[model samples]
Target: MLSYARQTLKRVPSFQELLQGTMGSAKEEISVDVLVIGAGPTGLGAAKRLNQIDGPSWLIVDSNETPGGLASTDVTPEGFLYDVGGHVIFSHYKYFDDCIDEALPNEDDWYTHQRISYVRCKELWVPYPFQNNISMLPKEDQSRCVDSMIDAFVEARISATKPKDFDEWIVRNMGVGVADLFMRPYNYKVWAVPTTKWEQMQCAWLGERVAAPDVKKVITNVIHNKTAGGWGPNATFRFPARDGTGGIWIAVAKTLPKSNTRFGEHGAVTKIDADAHRATLKDGTVVKYQKMVNTMAVDSLVQHMGDKELVDLSKGLFYSSTHVIGVGIRGERPERIGDKCWLYFPEDNCPFYRATIFSNYSPYNQPQKDVKLPTQQLANGSKPSSSEAKEGPYWSIMVEVSESSMKPVDGKSLLADCIQGLVNTDMIKPTDEIVSTYHRRFDHGYPTPTLEREGVLKQLLPALQAKDIWSRGRFGSWRYEVGNQDHSFMLGVEAADNIVNGAVELTLNYPDFVNGRQNTERRLVEGAQVFAKSKKSVD
Candidate 1:
């Protein structure tokens, strides 16, 4: 029944067929009122706000098939799960809480736990906020710390000017004893940059991050041989019960309209014509928009935009790289590691700055009890006695190693070095069975608040805003003070509001003001009435 003319006619291609590259031309064109790039907290926040308002046509795109940027989680082929690093839920805004609660709404959706943390020094576990628990140190060490504290207290009384750098700040506050013993080495490991390089960094973010020791209280505690309890807002935290932190973002993305979002390779932004307000995607699709909310790193954004001026302006910004390693061991949770949430390593015994008992956060963090996996090797570097696959209880530890041009790490031997470090630090027995291991590196990790940071951001932000492009995220703003999951989310929310209704970006402009207290005004369903129509105070 086939005719020659009928057989020659091509069928109309389906959307799925077009996406799969099965038929039709590869190029397309689209236009929207707002374009959001990178579906992390920042981009998602912008999209959420844009959806709330009915006026503008908007679309959000990300190169990644999934959301959650640096806040993402990953799983090993063996089923062991690990987050990019330590990510805990402690929010300043009700909108953030609302979004998370909306994503993970059921009572069984999360687990609430008290924070139990410690610092490893002198082969003894000392309560955190090490200066406040000098009592736990050896008697000679304790006396040395107290003497230095007294000297620092006296010096602080006579000093009139603010501490010039982080080193001086530490000495004036904690004295030489605590500074040399803990603050200096611990911070160096965490930042992968020396404290003496404080001129290239800032200490303003130290308020809640660092606990200032009270002279009288510290002395009294030392006299009584007491340990300090948990400190700061993260004293208690929550974790998603099923998938890791990535689950939160994925769930939140589900609440948004599918038509307004594009992910995967077709969504990758290849080139941005800031002048023409057009963005070319990898698949040769072009998107023209009135405004852009960019969540990608500022440096990356500049390179993509191909603006040499912006690229040169962003050179002053400095950052460190992060290496996240996870080790899955087949056994019951060790007695010494009982219920510890996270532990800080100041000594050289471990290459990692911190190790989190990731499995303790949720039973689902590792493979089910029934799944079987054979040991790759003994922690001591010995061959496994048995090659047969093994079943049963399992536990895992996640470690973070910081690196930069200042502090280099050997990528090839990193996993082996980390395992040996676990043994050297007494975190695992020499013969412990290691079932699975995971390693990932993020080039743009911690954004260092260099001495020149303020000057650079002042110029860069305004110049980009001139083109109707709002670069506003962790690296986008280059302000670590408001770079947590909660703050990053609000940055996008505020950016969208600014585009739509000329609202003030309180979180971006006034980090200290927003961080100092609870930000309850901005809710998902109910917009912030006060800041919604207020003009931005900062240019």
Candidate 2:
């Protein structure tokens, strides 16, 4: 089945060379000014920039047939779509916004949603940004948090230096109650690492990203029993109108010159001769370039280059895998769900750390309103009658599970367990009919911001840049502060600017500095044609 799908897709005009190279005997060698590895958002961003510049000949390649990397999406047999976890399109740069806007142009091309987020505690819904909303907590718990905040405020007055680790930073800012209740465990569930193992230097990303409590306001709210709303930069976000997040990238790729982009079999880069400035594809075609922009994970890139020193240096970095699970049900949207965007889970009641009301993103994410299907089972393990196929509308929920050596998961029954968890958490009703499900595991889901991460990246990145190779991206540079889709895309854009114009690569080096402001300097300019050839290409 996979082979037939590959063959059928290869017949597309844009994939002619890819098909010939994969199935035919004619292998070719070509050279360009630049070679890009990985067709994820970062790689696409670089390729798009290179195409705009028209300065250096370039070609972008990836192991996967489609783009998006960890930000991609998948569909179930019953026509339900789910992104890798809950992908929200919140941009910190105009370029990022423009690129997406250019791909999905119509008003109906996207779904704009206001963020409705919360933290699930002992049967209570704590408004997100837990530090600022202590009124939801029990009276005793509120007292503990307030006392610690006062103590931290006092300590800050006397201390001349900054906190040493994430734990200390939390204690110094949020106090003990909030930390013990939500900050510590919630972070662990998300990062898959202990708070102490994280460096304080990374706190800069959370500067304004996480809301700091206004002590006076909190006290007033607690006394008044007022609840806080979602507060922070990403209080609202956008999602693609179709094809999930991957649809956005695929559309972006379509806007680029066909000759410069490769996917599927031809996209796979099997061997890299760094000294020879050459890369070999699975079909035995060799491509040489003057400079290479690699967006693949640093470790994978090192292995492809066959460099011992680089591989050993990459070992200092650590990462956790992610499993995205989706559940599609046949019923009216639950009244309890309302318009919630995503919810955080800190306890062990469910293996997943977060769940998004995926159906809320777009009505088309599930089967059509008129499609007919049967119920597989109920949320409470009850069998539903095999009745006539009938449907009006459908909705879904996507859950994300982080896995590492410290936090292992049972892959065998993970889907079943997650479904049961949904029922336990009141996410779905006991007799709700289950219609579709989706699950995908990505090995490099997140780049851990461990205490040792900075030291290693300090040495590894420069060493590669010295070799005229710029390694930048989410996992490429290994900094979570700059690992989001926006940051990752800009990392590539900035890398290209640095290589072509000697512009300062701010996003690659100083994540805090770039993240602290609106970053207006990175906007797109009209008539900035970097490529000389016609944008049109022959199949």
Q: Mind sharing the TM-score for model 1?
A: 0.92
Expressed as tens digits, the lDDT of each residue in 60-127 for candidate 2 is 88878888777777888889998886777887677888888998889989888888888888778888
Which regions of candidate 1 deviate over 4 angstroms? 1-26, 517-539
**Residue lDDT tens for model 1, 1-539:** 00123233233333355567675455756667788998998999999988897577788999999988878899999998899989988877788898789888999999998989888998888988798999999999999899999898888999888887777788889999999899888888888897657566677766567787888889999999888777776788889998898888899899888767878887899999999999998989788777899999999999999999999999989999999999999999999999999999988878899999999999999998889999898988888999899896999999999998888999889888999988888899999999999999999989987778889999999889888889999998888888888889999998999888887788888776566633233343333453443434431
CA shift of 535, model 1, Å: 12
lDDT of 2 at 214: 74
Q: Highest lDDT among the candidates is held by which one?
A: 1
User: CA shift at 7, candidate 1, in angstroms?
Assistant: 43
CA shift of 510, model 2, Å:
2.3
Alpha-carbon deviation at 523 in model 1, angstroms: 8.8
